[model samples]
Target: MKKCRSLCMLFFVSFSLWNCEPDHKKYNLETSALLALTSTTSVPPGSSFKLPDANQTICYDTSGVTRACIGTGEDGEFTNTPAPFLLQIQDSGETILEESSELTWQRCPFGMVWTGSTCIGSSLNVYWQVANAYCNSLTTAGRNWRLPTAREASLLADHSQNTFLPNTYFPNGQGAGGWTSTPAVGFFGRYLVSSGGNVTPIDETTNFPFRCVSGPKAPNASFTDIGDGTIEEANTGLLIKKCAYGQADDSSCTGSASPLNWQQALDYCNNLNFASRTDWRLPSIRESYFISEPSIGNSNLPISIFPNSSQAAISWTGTTYNSTLSTAHAQMVYQMYVYSKTDSANVRARCVAGP
Candidate 1:
């Protein structure tokens, strides 16, 4: 009877222990299965899931890992965190994703090797002519490629990166200099670079390297005669003085504007009231380029609208030329090129109003 009682007690203890085991393990298994099903059913491949906020911008890391709310804190404040799923990065063709601009760029810059997502090769340090030729010859992604404009080349400047460029996308690119399609003063070409952390231009020659970009060109500029000794470029929305400063004539500038130093020219435009408007200032290199009609010989400007435009005249731009605070950039409208001139050097000024 005692032996039977002991056996029964042992069985009872074993049964109690078995029943006492925690139920959490089974619950966890069930929860995991439900999550898997929900994920599969809710999110489709190549589809995006919204972040916590609708305004939050999505960003990606160098390894193609995606994250959310990685903006520069310009549009309000927010916290950044890694996204749940990796983005599908495609590197199969002549184009790859340019994360910064979110545009697809060519896998290589003309003569470089496309290594998966990035281009890897030394850039050819060629002249403006050669650079343009190389870019024109390129046939990538079934499209013709051409050299980037100054504005387009400026987009590649990434101050956050060590080389001031997105090296991951433009590997082996020269950070100091790259040629732009925009012409500088004289026979030079405009090149974009961050010299001393400032976007500045240098004379384009056979010494500089260039990168090609593929995009729609800016639309042709249209002119409207304001009839108040000024004309408005319809495309750029800039009000240009009909005649150069100091050569003010309703019909045409009989003489060239008196060449003043950079500072003098700036002050002249700022103080002088024109066209019943007080806000007159120097045009930027870009702004000056906008008015330039390279097809027109001699004056390189629309002669009928802007009469007496001189090819020999070099106009001072508001932009500084280099790291030197004392120098400024000037544009030669006739040749469509840029060159650096001292602040004290005598240069012409054509005032512009509005952007």
Candidate 2:
């Protein structure tokens, strides 16, 4: 009996020393299991978690005898404290991302021209029917269409930089009202005029200016080469065609193209399906000319189609003036004017795509 007691006492002392060792990495986990369970685990402050959650946030000191963090709604319940409290080291090493908001947007690459610090572009002013039809025609690069957001429209200001002007000069005092995706404050997302400078709420029937946007104009994309290629994945149903017949000039054919008429043109490009595409339509004047080459007289079309195309004769565009040419009164209608092969000639129609 005395020998057994001495052996038992010796075993206890040896076991205690083994567990008290500082270097735990060298210790076998199976053998260390015999040690205190609480000693190996850490708890942090400002960390919250549930049992199913394995992401342990070390935001607290998980040392010594701490409160028992267990049970459903007891002290162990995951609260506002971080488990294993410690300052979180950033893994991505980034705290901010490039903002997509209009305020942060400095330039527009697709159809917009720089005015001051803001980007400005032309838009069609028409009733709801014409407005929707017009928006359906805009195509940037290969993208068929996109209406500007309220914020995007409001971002355009006379004091801002990068805006479109009537003249080639960017800073020229030329601006147009644009389309807005934002609904009025008191109304739905409708009846508003966006000028990239101000958002004026109006009735849907009121004629207003509008602008077009390229599909998420990426950094790698070029403004001058807005429509230069085709898409590999055509989920939008319309393919991006870099043709010149629909553009103002050879220099401006970098946008999408759809062979269509004014009425069917919108449907053809925006809705697609020249044969089967669901998104197809005609491009707006600005969008159609994002890649427009300047011409003098009615000279947008190919010389073969309109033989009169010359330096003096500018080409005709699909977009028409709202008011008819008359010395007596003004009329409201979408009309296009440009050089024609004949004095009073109507040419074969073309189309473009939009988002």
Candidate 3:
């Protein structure tokens, strides 16, 4: 009977210990899982769980690998974190974005009138005020503006089109004969007005008109005469004057005039006695008229040639008055009436030749 009682007690103790072992192991496993779950981004399989502690973020995923770290809520809860995002930028390389919106005012060359991108008008006319006002009222790109500098003004005159105005704008138009930005000093033999930075008398207030232009700054030089290795100014261009002998006006005589009778003057010319060149000739009545000097009443010389050694004086032509005495001469002088009477002996003579 004693042996049986001892065996029963030992069996009871072994059964109790075996049952407690499983509970202890499960508790340890649960603790380990909770520690990992504190990250707020992982989950354990087949387990009902909460945040490790009130401050724990409780990152949880379906498989515990796909992570989403987020801040913990007041009750240790978490909101869904937004997905990742990206940004993009645009690029603009080396090109100017032109504003081709509408018509506006623009300045043309000094002597030109603006008609869109083209400039037109006589090279002799178009003074400053007219030009400025016209430019101010001229419309391009939706604005009115004054003409550009000599350089900027020339862009409108396209020699390739042979047009002062583009053919597209003026189909029946002649060669492009508009204002330019080039100054007269460079190739036009520098004018008096140009020296003072003023417009020519031909472009007087009552004579010339204005054109408008506006756009990019006018360049330094406008039209280039590739043919003659020259550049035409925006205002004057190559139209101002034509080249002749070294002489300008009628007074351009290479040799001193000798007081002579009609026969003597003729003989002198035939001899090529003047300027070493043999092609000397007695000018026609019309040609001689340009050399005639107006009577300034002997007051100081006119400002035209004052201070300059080149004094202008009237000269006689070789033209004959009639079949009268073989030596009768018809002298051509400036500012004289064609029907007026005049003495022949008092007339002065200047000789001219061509190169």
lDDT agreement with native, every candidate = 0.49, 0.29, 0.28
Q: Which tens-of-lDDT digit does each residue in 1-355 have in candidate 3?
A: 3234323433454355447544322334454344222112112343221111111123222122213333211111212111011111111110111122111122232333444344455333433333333444533345435443322221223211112243444333433222322223212210111211122212112223333443333111123232321122231121111111223323322332334444344444445433334544444332232222222322112323222232233333343322121222233212211111133343333443331
Cα lDDT tens digits, model 1, 126-185, are 545456555666555666567665444433443233364445545565463466565443
Cα-based RMSD of candidate 2: 32.6
Best by TM-score: 1
lDDT of 1: 0.49
1 or 2, greater by lDDT: 1
As for candidate 1, its clashing pairs are: 184-337, 184-338, 185-332, 185-337, 185-338
Candidate 2 global CA lDDT score: 0.29
In Å, residue 305's CA in model 2 sits off its true spot by 62
Q: Rank the candidates by lDDT, best first.
A: 1, 2, 3
Write the number of the candidate with greater TM-score, choosing between 1 and 2.
1
Candidate number of the best lDDT: 1
Q: What are the runs in model 2 whose C-alpha is more than 4 Å off? A: 1-124, 158-173, 188-196, 217-355
Per-candidate RMSD, Å: 25.3, 32.6, 46.5
Ranking by TM-score: 1, 2, 3
Ten-residue region with minimum lDDT total, candidate 1: 74-83
- Summed over model 2, clashes come to 94
Per-candidate TM-scores read 0.55, 0.25, 0.23
Clashes of 3: 40
